[model samples]
Target: MEKGIESIFKPYLEPKEVYKGGKNIPASTKKIYKLSSNENPLGQSPKATEALIKAAQNIALYPDQTDIRLREALVLDFDHKLAADQFITGNSGSEIIDMILRAFINEGDEVIFSNPCFLPYSVFSRWYGAKQIDVRLKDFDYSLDVEGILNAITERTKIIFLTGPNNPTGTYIPKAVLEDFLARIPKNILVVYDEVYRQFADAEDYVTALPYVMQGYNIVGLNSFSKTYGLAGQRIGYCYTTAKIANYIRQIHKPFLLPITSIEAAIGALNDKEFIANTVKTVQDGKIFLADAFASLGIKYWPTQANFFIIDPPLPEMEFTDFLMAQGVMVRPVSQFGAPGKVRISIGDQEANEALVQALVKIKTR
Candidate 1:
């Protein structure tokens, strides 16, 4: 123990034995299609790979600190008020989140968010000595309860994080409802709109957090190249905030955190409009396939606008997930997402989805 470091360390979340599903599957079960995390099953963008290889040629040099190309690419594609001054790149969406909580929250300040969201929001909040406030979703649809969230705020509230086409449940908040909530909330509080899965949305009512940025709600919109562009391995994600705040964050950001190759590849992925359009189509088809299978199995599922949906398990989720692993399929058990009886399954490719459905049926019949 370092002297001053020991007193500053605050722990609120215990590290669970995270099931990085099926790391040790038997050889017979080795053919398993991992649909555990909401990853792009179709794999990385072809263009991203090409760019990455070209970038690998420059490995001898230190990565560029500014990461110019990707920042300009993001600027041209998005219509928000953000300039290059307003963006701060990180290794991933989680890294941007960790930066925000540490930079903005002081000890004892309250952080509010919907329950069962990405676990890191609460975990990171507590790590900063801030209070964690969870407002329960109304039902399995995982629709946000605006009144519930608004009531949770007080003078102590420092941040409110809301995910659109949210994780685990694949549900979204409607524009009118979101507008109403945003309008009513106290102006001082910062609302972080995490839009990692926004690209997978099939609904006509979907709202990107960009407009909120334009309106200057003291909001920060977190976007990722991970899901749609299949740049997960490159770990590129960032936030759009007011220019002043972004400059403030840069003071604490690790120098050269964004690798030059990731910037080039991410830039390349953005211009691969055809590949992105195709990825969206594939993900939509997958959502339909999973929905149909759930209906046929007599299992209930939330109506999803994202490429995944949450299912109410007939058996306990952890046990059911273990059973699926034995049959050479993998899924996320939502026990860790604070819904012990339900599990989330990412919509994979056609053959993989079919295999999952078959394995699920066999498990139920037994």
Candidate 2:
């Protein structure tokens, strides 16, 4: 048997369970509200359809090996001096994360980030044979522990993953605190800011780290068209960084991995300003609506800036999730993301929110 296969690999293996999260549903289900995955329930942009239709005949030919169209769109969107050599498109956000870790880490190097961060961030670090140093969050809200992350670093520390409008928790690190944190860290260490929900940040405090990239900071930003653009099923994501790091990432990644359709959709999504604006408005409104509902029910929840928010469960997270599911509401159980007692709910459209509210009310009454 291969040395890295079978039992030696078995211990670290994870069974990815696919649950019904609003993306797939039965036609006969009543109301059929889906609040899982933190995706845009508002539907995709018309521009995407137009592009896909235009590109349909081109699939027989290989997708642009370099993914030029999407890269151009991203560079234009960022409106910085990013050269064409500075971006790499991938199968999904997950693939980009994998490629980056593979590009940097060797055996026994250290990767420091936050506890209760993105579920797969730690997974990838461990997969790449790096020691994972987790800085615990300040509170149940899961804010970044900048000082702890700094203190955790040593000569062996190679990478740090920072998530803004952080998943499940939805808290953001302000620019000043980030500046301080960045200033303290050695410039050679790589900082990955997962700004997957950057579009949804309405507050001025929610600044993205892209400016760091333009300034040639040792920082990389990962983004997915899945959440804001409703393209999760299409599996398109990209990383933006300084040309040097991006070239390294490109060399480590599988070439021609992205399909033409996904790239086409991503390009259209970039140009769809109305779609971004509307998605942000809906998610922001949905967050407020859910927060108010939680307050009315006297349920404590972490205030958030992302599309999803975390609420401490009145019962085990799984049990509350099941009860909500039975009541025709679907949400993410945060156990996989390192919070066992909190459930993360994606703010859905008006009807779905009303259903979730009614379910919570009934559950509270009982």
Candidate 3:
């Protein structure tokens, strides 16, 4: 390796063992159930699958440079408060995050977020040379500390990353709290609302950050078809912001950011309201079943509004996660996301949920 190579690129954040599959998996294990990533347990919409296949026939051509169709579908199907021109499409939510950072973050600028946030917030901030300000979650409920964030603000602060139904923890900011927080924030600083799992959130008090954008606030709402529509492999996501910010991101973004098939699949998935409903229902039911099993087993877990929840296993985090994996179930040990001694479990299908409970029972007995 060259001696100066380290200085040229940022270090990569290595994923955990569950993401690095096939290394420790037993040879005799059959039908491994993957519930690590918060994916739709039910498969993709049939309409989306068909669109993907049909779009593949013209794979030789470039996708629409502006991605007008997908943006229009997003507005017409999900959010109509903002026009299509206000949206910026990307390969994934990760890419949109990168775009936002690139467009707004300059070297030495400050970025604020809670600890145990979506891991990429820090990674991207470091890559762009932004000073990170991590506010610890409240001790009791692990919710974001709004007052702490307000106090952390400085003249150099550029962006604040807020995740509703935050990854790993699945804790969300309530509507009133969020409204009050936004009202107090300095308008010069941008707020990024990461809502990839918004479709699965069932809490009555949960609210989308889209209306703030329509109200001409300095906020960007990020969403993805990956979790909601089973399009993770397709790598498509979008963000809604002010037209001015959208233009700034677009000016620096390369054209054809998404593939033709991915765009078509999102459009088709949006049309299939029935599939979305069933996916939401399946996750909700599995959440109840898993929560009940955990309670009966005397295991403690965080109440979640999203498709996944964090649980404190009887053993160490990795030990429990490894045991579950050996039993053909994959759950995420979220020490990397700052919740040590806890494991995050995504809601799975009926069979997978039952299998997980059975494995947990075995652990309890052992």
Top candidate, metric lDDT: 3
Q: Point out where model 1 deviates above 4 Å.
A: 1-29, 79-82
TM-score of each: 0.92, 0.92, 0.93
Summarize candidate 3's per-residue lDDT along 105-139 as a digit string, tens digits. 98889999887767888877777778889997885
For model 1 the local lDDT of residue 27 reads 63
Question: Which lDDT tens digits does candidate 1 get at residues 1-366?
Answer: 558855645555346333232233346726888777777868888888899999999988888877555667778777534587778788989889999998889989999988677788887787777888999777746789899988889999989999888877788888888888889989888888988888888678789777877777778888888888898778889888877667887788886778878888888888888888888888899888888889988999989877788888777887888888888888877766767688888788888898899998997788
Of candidate 1, the 10-residue stretch with the lowest lDDT total is 16-25
TM-score-wise, the better of 2 and 3 is: 3
Superposed by TM-score, candidate 3 places the C-alpha of residue 338 at a distance from the truth, in angstroms, of 1.2
- What overall lDDT, based on C-alpha atoms, would model 2 receive against the true structure? 0.82
Model 1: how far is 314 from its true place, Å? 2.5
lDDT of 3: 0.87
**Model 3 poorest 10 in a row by lDDT:** 16-25
List the pairs of residues colliding in candidate 1.
none
